[model samples]
Target: MAEAVAAGRAASRGVPGRSASGRSRHARILAALVALSALVYAASSLLRLRAFQASTYDLVIFDQALRSYSRFGAPVAMVKGVHNGFGPDFSVLGDHFSPILAVLAPLYWLHDGPETLLVAQAVLFALAAVPVWRYAARRFGPVSAHLVAGAYALSWPIAEALAFDFHEVAFVPLLSALLVERYDAGRRVQAALAAAGLLMVKEDMGLLLVGFGFFLLARRGERRAGAAYAAAGIAATWASSRVLISLFGGDNDYYWAYGSLGDGMADAAVRVLTHPWILPGAVGSPPVKLLTMALLVVPLLLLPLRSPLALAALPLLAERMLADRFPNWWEPGYHYNAFIVAILVMAAVDGAYRLRGRRPPAALTRLRPVAALRRSRPVAALRRMRPWRALRRHLPAAALLAGAVVTVPFFAFGDLADPGLYRPDGRDRAAGAAVAAVPDGALVETANNLGPALSARTRVLLWDREPRGAPWVVADIGRHTFPFTTLEEQRHRVARLINEGYRPVFRQAGYIVLTRESAAPR
Candidate 1:
């Protein structure tokens, strides 16, 4: 009988069987760590809000869309519409199929501020660590699971993307993590819900699901499920291309990321199907592809590669590497990582489970370089030293701790690779107060940072735009360094505003609030 095991078993961390309480204790610890992650992310949110670090471009666009949804209307993005030449009320929903933002509409009714969105983003990113904890704990043991969760909570990509600004991609990590966990556990219903949730996030998720379906086919051998997922992805891609975005978004297709392949998405698709070798050549060169993988895997100690799950990242990797327009996508730091990071970490945790409590192979110790070192009397004596046994026993824990340390910088700024963005002096109180005075529904042209605050209150055009009889204009003349480099260039627009029948209403700290001479305060 090959060793009859106990009906209920016990092992420490990754040692396998454990009593119920031990598992609960591990979960509680991991939860506490996730809370810590939330606190850290919240602090970043606060800094961004108070310091004027947040931008109106993305924030205002999202808030407008969410508010429109709250009002039970099509998500016509007033802000994005103006700048992209899409008119004052174009459907942002067409641009990206994120009905998921509607879920946040109720929350907007409660607090109705851009800060609400920021904190929500922080919480979502923090919660993503849950699946990481669950997967890692089950595979590696609770202790190592906590380590993986902590490292995941601090993963560079999450921090950078969150810190950069609120994006629809905020939901990606959580959804992807759920998809992996439920799928691995054979919870088909939950897995399908999670997979469907991805399409609701953004159009790109359709392709991602197709790739993941293949991963499922290859790994799970569930041909029906895999084919269904792929079919759904293909359907979404076709719908988005032919109808969805075209109906709601700008007049032209905006998928310029693949501009290198052809004129637009249609041409790009043709090129991809007809010319198979185009993928390898357009991976931004082999060296870049190698570096992109290294940056992603190195922070986790290259453990994710042990699992076939890494194959799921291929569609995203291909999408990015193939995009000649978005060089930023070729790197690990930005919002691009939001889509790819979860599964890689899941793979790492799963890999760690296989690694836990195992000794280094005799083959590893017997490698030529190791054997040569062992032949040295000093090295051999060191290997025979007192602490060697202890080192062997705790080596896995040490590795987890070390990798966690390596990824610490990312935790500092809500995204690891972009630390220089942390300018703590971000709040402009006087400017905020002036912005608060603007009435809701009034047309106002405002600075980038100020736009998020005033989004719900008024129609905000980018500051530099010619007011075109807009009733108000707000400019922080001295606050010229962020959101864009064109703020100083807008100084000329101030003269233009005065020339075009606008009068200054308030001025302090380079923040000048203006209204049309016809509509100026009596």
Candidate 2:
């Protein structure tokens, strides 16, 4: 087994056709591309914040959580608590099992603001390119490596994650790539470490780890390790979601998105086993689910379908698709897809390599007729065709790269081309002034759009329905903000506050700053 594995590795190295210096040069070029990607991602996200396009539901929630972490306090996110009607003492962990956000606390130590989280997320997304390039280089050539790396970096999943806000998934792409690359390279220890980190990212990440274990089990001499990993993943997911989350004051019932399947996980599993069509029924009824599944593979020209490594994505995909409560999970948007981007791209590289080497799947090798047909005249003639040869080798990567480039104009990255992305208008200035009117350290209720802007300075609660009686209020009445469906609803709320002794102290560009008359002035 060792000899055969070594021979395969040698063949992969030889196929790349690069000398030591050439390989080093390619590495340097790939590094430059990764740096450029990071810059672009950071600039785009930060610019959105500057333009008042960032929302408080998430960006501010994460910001508040990270702030507590930076200060060595509990992972409290008042924005989330206030929005959800939980009190200011609420811990973010009670909502989702992502302790990995604490790793980013050091970034807050340097900048101490929401912008720090956005920049950190961009860097994390860009860092995945390194592992992706290394893995692709081992399978394909240097050129294909670069193409795959670029494609992964610019993929729509990462773009959507960036467009939405900072999320725990920012750590997923890099860790998933590392796990696949290191495991394939026979460095089980590093791969295990990556898997461990993945478990920290979210409670559901263990399902992805379990899928990877199934992938490993299919490979020679890996069954023992695979079994151990699969068992660990199962244990970790159960402990984290059921025990850890509950221990942290979270209600797991809130995440029961599979009500349509059954009462709970056990019931759903039993139903899925007994009525297999139930899974398909759920996925098919919403035609958008099919479109999303297609969009995931279509960009890579369906190469992922050919590799068993794609199994790593199945659990997560099923988790999202089977959930009927959250429509966003079934759609091809937000940070939901970011978890599988690395797995899909790595599988595509593996698929292309298998095609280039003319390696038939193990199952196909057992079929006598299939083996005989390989030596047939028609097969030989087809192999000799230039287009057929190209399709089996370099063309796959080139076509994938071309497709990625072609599709960039339709995704969030395309916003970089619009001049408006760079310009912050009067609304932004007014929001800033409104944020400024609320003195530092004062308790302020802010609109969902302006929460992040003041979260760094003021103690902010979401200015949603039912005033929290905060001493200072900053809301945008000129346009509708989150939690308020109409502009009149926002205006009426502000008017009610005024009649109750809260007076508008600052108003500009439809932004209003109100302070309670009875409260001591700052």
**Candidate closest to the true structure, highest lDDT:** 2
lDDT of 2 at 471: 91
- Best candidate per TM-score, number? 2
Q: Candidate 1 local accuracy as lDDT?
A: 0.72
lDDT of 2 by residue, 127-225 (tens): 888778778877667777778888988898899899987899999998999898888777889999999999999998999989998888988888888
lDDT of 1 by residue, 313-385 (tens): 7777777877777567786655787788888888776666567666779999889998788699997787788
Stretches of candidate 2 off by over 4 Å are: 1-17, 357-393, 517-522
TM-score for each candidate, following the candidate numbering: 0.84, 0.88
Error of 2 at 351 (Å): 1.6
lDDT measured at residue 491 in model 1 versus the true structure, 0 to 100: 74
lDDT of 1 at 45: 71
Report the CA-based lDDT of candidate 2 relative to the real structure. Answer: 0.83
Task: Tell me the whole-model lDDT of each prediction, alpha carbons only.
Answer: 0.72, 0.83
